[model samples]
Target: MAILVLGLALWVGAHLFKRIAPGMRARMTERMGNGSKGIFAIALALSVVLMVISYQRAAFVNVYVPPSWTVHLVDLFMILAIALFGLGSSKSNLRGKLRHPQLSGFALWAGLHLTVNGDLASVVLFGTLFVWAFVEMAVINASEPRPTPYTGGSTVGTIRLLVISLVLYAIITAVHAWLGVWPFPG
Candidate 1:
């Protein structure tokens, strides 16, 4: 629990720093030059390690038994979450319209996972991500009032979106198999 909490704090704190202390982040970036990316990469790597360890430790504690249907819902939501994430990240028609599609995808993914996972670690991890996504989205929306409208839907963009979404879905499915956690249990 300590590891999970600390990891969440580090991950969320790093993200929130930009929103909470924009000036500080700007000053640091200016001081660090391109090294800011290195700092961020290190922070991200550390957060992932902490999260994995925390989640492993948390598996010992059984908080609640989730309903079976929750898994199905999670699976469905996860697909949408992936599609939205790809659309958000890719140079697609959805990008300019949503202003923060990645954040929205994070919210959806975290919220969906929370519904399926009823454990202390799951709650902490998913809840923190959900809250962070909401806060980040709100901050971004406030900072950028008007969204830059997309020009027009492109056939190439649509194809790219579909291909990326399918590839990611396949990769996640493979990862699930490798981890021996069949999200969609037979």
Candidate 2:
């Protein structure tokens, strides 16, 4: 559990460094010269790996049990989360409307996961992330409002994003099952 917490701190801390301390992050990037992004990426990957191992090995203590019916909400939230994530990260018209779609997706993912998973570790992991995402979005929007009006988003783009999101969702759910937890149990 300690390791898991440490890993989470590292991963989320680095990712949110710019949001929290833009000057510090910028200074560090300049000091690192050309390898800054690469160095941070490697560190972030390592932190994520550590988190996975620590989380999987940690003991699960029951904190609260969410109703089983919330599993349906989890499924819905997970799919939309994935869709928004894909659209947000892609160079599509959707980005016009959802300036921070990826962060929004992550917030949704964490919030929805909390509905289904009531373990202390899950709460510690997902809950913090949920709060962090919202904070990041609010801070960013307040500082940097979207300049361009949304006009390019189209039905065709929406359809493509939907298909891609669905496919990714299927793959991710299968990976979850492979990891030994079937979210949508048969």
Candidate 3:
């Protein structure tokens, strides 16, 4: 649990460093030049590894038992979450509609996980990430001006995005099932 918390803290700190301490981040970036991104990437990778390892080993101390019905909801909402996740990078028209679609998707992913996982470890892990995504959104929204909406994506692009999102979601479900957690309620 301690390691999990540490991992979560590292994840949050690495992400928020630039927003929380602009001067310090600037100084580091100035010194490291292009390598600064590598540094952050390494930190994020390490944090994820730590969190994954710790979470797998964590004892299942129940916090609350989610109703079985949420299983179906998780599947449905996850499709939306996955689509929102791809919106930022996809050629879909909705790409420009949201300033932080990726973060919004990440938060949605984390929050949705909580509906099915009620253990303390799951709460701490997903809950912290959920909050961090919102905090990140707030910080970025404050620092940047609202973006102009784009008007140029074709319906084909959106259809392509949906297809890709659905495929990725299917793959993700397969991975979870391989790990012994089937997402769909039997």
Candidate 4:
């Protein structure tokens, strides 16, 4: 639980650093030069590792029992979340129309996970991310506004992104057995 909390804090803090403390980030960037990306990547990767390990090891304390219907809702929400996340990077029409699709997708992922799993570990894990996404979106949008709406994306790009997202979703679903937490409520 301690490791999980620490990981969550580090993950959120590292991500929010640039948004919350622009001057500090700039100074770090100046010091690190091109190495900032690698440092951030390492910190993020370690944070995830710590979170996964600690979460799996920690004792589960039931906060509430989720209804059976929420399993179906989780599936539905995961698809939308995956689509938004995967398509956010593509030159698709939806990308142009949406602001902060990736962050919204991540929030959806975390929020939906919380809906189905009402445990202390799950709450700490997903809830932190849920809040971070909103704060990150606000800070980023305020700091760097999109000067122009991307209006040149094609239908083909949209289709490609959806197909890719579906494929990626399928792969992750298949790997759930290895992860030991099947989203399906069987």
Leading candidate by TM-score? 3
Instruction: Estimate every model's Cα lDDT from 0 to 1.
Output: 0.79, 0.83, 0.93, 0.87
Clashing pairs in 3: none
> Can you list the residue pairs that collide in candidate 1?
none
- Cα deviation at 104, candidate 4, in Å, is 0.5
Ranking by TM-score: 3, 4, 2, 1
**Could you tally the backbone clashes for each prediction?**
0, 0, 0, 0
CA error at residue 28 for candidate 3, angstroms: 1.1
Candidate 4 to truth, TM: 0.94
Please report the candidate that would top lDDT against the real structure. Answer: 3
Go through the candidates in order and give the C-alpha RMSD of each one to the true structure.
1.9, 1.8, 1.0, 1.3
**Local accuracy of candidate 2 as per-residue lDDT tens digits, 1-186:** 888788888877777777778888788888987677787798789888877888788788999999989999898778889987777655566667877888989999999999999998888888888987888788888777667755666777888888888999999999999999998946
Candidate 2: 10-residue stretch with minimal lDDT? 86-95
Score candidate 1 by TM-score against the native: 0.89
Positional deviation of residue 121's Cα in model 1 after best superposition, in angstroms: 1.0
User: lDDT, candidate 3, residue 175?
Assistant: 96
Please provide, for model 1 over 150-180, each residue's C-alpha lDDT reduced to its tens digit, 9 standing for 90 to 100: 6666768867887887788789888978877
Runs of candidate 2 exceeding 4 Å displacement: 91-93
Candidate 2 to native Cα RMSD, angstroms: 1.8
TM-score, per-candidate, Cα-based: 0.89, 0.90, 0.96, 0.94
Instruction: For residues 6-108, write the lDDT of model 4, one tens digit per residue.
Output: 9998898889887788898888889998788788888999999999899989897999898889989988778889888876688787877778888999999
The ten-residue window of minimal lDDT in model 4 covers 145-154
